[model samples]
Target: MFTSREGVTLDSIAAPLRRWLLNPVLTVPAALVLSGFATATPNTDSIKFLVPVCALVLAGVLLSLNDYLDKQFANNWVSDNTWNWDEEIVVVTGGSVGIGASICDQLLARNSRTRIVVIDYAPLGWQPKQEETRLSYYQCDLSDSNALRSTCERIRSEVGHPTVLFNNAGLVRGVSIMDGSYGDIEATVRTNLIAPMLLAKEFLPEMVKRDHGHILHTGSLSCVTPPALIADYAATKAGLLALHKALQLELKNIHNAPRVRLTIGIFSFIRTALISGHTNVPNFLLPLLHVDTVGEAMVSAVYSGYGSTIYLPGFNRVASTLRGGPEWFFRILREATANFRINFRGRHEVDSQTGKILKA
Candidate 1:
C-alpha cells in the first residue's frame, strides 16, 4: 500500500485492502484461512469452516486445468518455436471487421516486423487503421473453397508461411431453420465451420514442418449451451469446438508436432456489428464484452505463445460446465431468459437488410 519513499498512509492502506477484499480470488483464500482458525476454536461448527474450504479447493482445481493445459502446450511448442512476434507472420480470417480488426490493430502495433494478412470478402478500404502498410488485405469469401485456396496460396507466396493463424471469421442469420434460406444456411455453415477447417488444412502442415506455430479458433458460448432461434449458428460453433479439439489431438499425437499450439476462445455476447441490434442474456450475469479487450487477449496469447481453451470473461468456464449438471438448472435458465432469443421476434429474412415473415 505504501511507496518506499512515502511510507504507509491510512488512505493508501484502505484502498488496497478494499481491493483485496473485493477480489474474489484473494478473498477466497483469506476466507479459507479464517475458516481454518474457526475450525480450531472450541464449540465452532466444523461444517461452516469445511464448506467454503471445499468450494475454494474445487474451484481452484477447475481453474488450474487451463493453466495446466497451457503449460503442457508451452512445453512442446515454445520449446521448439518460441515466441518471436517480430519473426512471426500472422494471418487473420475475417480481419476486415469486428474483433478481427481489433486483433490486427494490436498485432500491427505490437511489432513492426510482424506482417499481418487479413482474409475477408469485405473491403478493408474503409478501415482507417489499416492505412499503415504493415497490414495486408485479400478479398476472398471463405465459403468459396477455390477462392480461399487461391488467396492462401497468394498469401503464402507473398508473405511467407504465416506462423500464426487466427480463425476468427464467423456469421449468423439469427433465424430458425424454417426462416433461413438455403443460400444463407450454406453460407453460415461454410463460413463458420468448413472455412476454419480449410484454413487449418492450408496452413497447419507448414507449421508442422517448421516445428513451430499457433492456431487460435474463435469458438462460442453456443458450443456449450446451444440456444434457440440461431440453431445453425449454434450447430456450427459446436462443430468447430469438436473439430478444433480433434485437430489438436491429431497434431500432437499423430504428426508428433507438439510444437504447434492450439487455442480455442469461447466468448459470450460480444459488442460487435455481427451481433448488433441483438440482446444478450441479462447483462447482470453475462455482460456484453468489448471487442478490443477480447482482441487484446487473443493477440497477447498468440504473440506470447500462450496456449489453452480460453473462456472470455472467464466465469463462463464454470457456466459451460453446467451442461453436465442437472436438468432443472438448464430449465430454469431457459425459462428465465428464454435463451436471449427474444430479439429475433419471429421475423424471416424477406430481404438482405430487414427480416419480416412473408405473406405465407
Candidate 2:
C-alpha cells in the first residue's frame, strides 16, 4: 500500500530543497553562481571576474545541450500532438520476470488504449495487479532464432505491429571467464545481444514505413564501470549501449525516420529476481533501485515519446561523465565500493575437490 500525500511535515517542506540540491541541472548552475559571487569583490582582480564569467557561460551552454540531448532520439513525442497511448502497442521481451514484469505492470496501470505483448519462454508465476484487458503473453524463447521468428509472426497476426519494443530480456551466469563454459558465453550473447537485433529486423521496417516507433534498450551501469566478475554479462550490456547508439543514428540520418526513437536505460543494481543473488555497493551509499521507480520512468517515456539514456537514482548521470577518466580509477573505485559481495558470485555450490564454482 502507498501512503497518501495529504499530510505535510518538516521533511515534506524540505523535499523541494533536497531535490534541487541533488539535481545536476540545478547543481551546475548553483556552482557557477557561487563561483561568480566569490569574484564580485573589490579586489580589482580581472582574472577572477573573467574566469567566473566564462565558467557561467560554459555551464549555461552545457545545460542547454543536455536539454537538447534529452530529445536526441526523436522529435516524435511532442506534448501538443494528437498522439496518445490509446494508439500504441507495447512489446516487452523477458517480460515474465523481474524488471520486465515491473515495466508491464506500469504500462497496464495507465489503463489506456495501448495494447501490450509479453514474449518469454518462462511461464509467469505472478499476474499483473491491474487486471488488464489490453495485455497478452506469447511463449517465445528469445534466444532461439527460429522460436523468435515464429512467435513474432504470430504476434503480428494476432495483435498488430508493436509500436514500442523494450529489449529487456537478460541473464547473468556470475562466473569469471576462466570458470565459465562456451555454452554459457553463447547463451548470454544470444539472449542479451542477438535477440534484440532479430527483433529489430523483424519489426523496424514497418516502423520506418510509418515513421513511428520507440526502442528501449535496457543497459546497465556495468557497461561503464565493469566489475571483475560477470564478464559475459557486462559484455552483452555494453553491446546494448553500442547497438542503441548505432540504431538511433540509422533511424535518424540514413532512414530519415527521425521520429523513430531509441532510448538507452543505464541503471545500477535494481532490486529484482533477475539479479537477486548478485552483490551490490554498500546500501548506505547506493540503495538498491526500486522496481516502482524504474517502472514509472519507463511508462513516462513511452507515453511522452522521447528517448535518451536514463540513469537510475537520477544522480547516476555522473556515471556517463566519469567514463572519460582513466580505466584504473574505475577499477580501484569498484574494488573499494562494491567489492563486498564480489566473492559471493553464483549460487552456494562450490566444487569440494577443486574449490571452483560447481554450476556455471
Candidate 3:
C-alpha cells in the first residue's frame, strides 16, 4: 500500500472512506446526501435514511463551525499573510529523536525552501541526505538554564531568528514522587517545563516585534489525567499546559502580539522511546499514537498561519470538558487509570549538580 506523509494510505478506497468518516467536514457524505435527495423515491425508507443522514450532517456542521470559530478567535480574528516559507527559520527542541525528529522531517517534506534548526543534547540519529542543505543541528543540554540561554543566543546569532519554535523536547522519570532522586525531579522539570519557557523568552520578543511567529508545544494528556508512578512527569506536563495558556494571554494582552500564533498539542501516550516500557491496558481504546500522525498535525497547524488547540485522535477533547465536571467524576477517572503502570525502560542516573546523565 501507499502511505503518504501524513500516514494515510491512498492505495485503496478504504483510506478516503476512513478519512471522510473521521473528518468533521463530511464532504463525501454531504455529496452523497445531495445524490440521495435527487434520486430518492417518495417512500418511508427514504425518510428514515434522510432523517439520520440529516442529523449527522447537522452534527458535522456544528463541529465544523466550532473548529472555524476556535481557529479565528485563537488568531485574534486576523489572518497573517507574512509567512514566507523561503525565509522562515524553524527551531525544534529534542529534534534528534522521537516526536521531535518526526516534526523536523514533516516540516522539511512540506516545504523545500523552509530551514530547520534542531537543538538537542544528543547527536542527530540519522544522517541527513546530501541535498538536504536547509537543516542545521545544534547540540545543547536544555535542562541547565545557563546552557539553554547560551544555546539560544548562539542559535539567533548563527542561524538567524527562528520564526517557528517547536518546544518538543521532554523527559519522564517513571518513578513515584518519593522514589525519584532530586536530580531526576529537577531534570524532568527543567527539560519539560523550564526549557520551553526559557526558549520562548529567547525567541518570543523578536516574534512579537515582527507580530508573526508560531510556538507549538507538545503537551500531554497527563496534564488533566495524572496517573500514578510518574508524579514528576505529570507535574511538569501540567505546568507546561498552564504556561501555554498564560503565554497565549500575555502574547495578546501584554505583548500586543496577537499574530504570534500559540498552539499546544495535548496528546495521549505516543509510540516512542520516551514511553518505552509503559504499556496501556486495554490498548485498543488508548492506543499509542504514531509519531508522524502528531508531527503532521503540528506542522499543518503552523502552515495554516493560525493558532490552535490540537487534541490528537480527536476524542481526547473530552479531557477539557472533564476538567470542569464534578469532583467525583474526576476522582473516578484518576483511580481507574492509576494502575496503568509506567516502567520507563530508559531511566538513567543523572549528576546531582548538572542534571546530566551519569549512568544508563
Point to the candidate with the largest lDDT.
Answer: 3
User: Lowest-scoring 10 consecutive residues by lDDT in candidate 1?
Assistant: 351-360
Cα lDDT of all candidates, in order?
0.72, 0.70, 0.79
Q: Alpha carbon lDDT of residue 136, candidate 2? A: 83
Clashes of each: 0, 0, 0
Ranking by TM-score: 3, 2, 1
Residue 160, model 2: Cα distance from true site in angstroms: 0.8
* Weakest ten-residue segment in model 2 by summed lDDT: 1-10
User: What's model 1's lDDT at 9?
Assistant: 34
**Per-residue lDDT for 80-188 in model 1, tens only?**
4466776788999878878898888888777756788989776773353444446678988787788899999999999889989999987777667887767556777
Q: Please report the candidate that would top TM-score against the real structure.
A: 3
The CA-based lDDT of model 3 is what? 0.79
Clashes of 1: 0
After superposition on all C-alphas, the RMSD of every candidate to the true structure, in Å, is 8.0, 7.1, 3.9
Q: Residues 204-305, candidate 3, lDDT per residue (tens digit)? A: 989999999999999888888888877788888888888888988898899999999999998988887776644455544455678988898899999989
Q: Kindly report which residue stretches of model 1 are placed more than 4 angstroms away from their true locations once superposed.
A: 1-66, 73-81, 125-133, 278-282, 337-360
Model 2 has a clash total of: 0
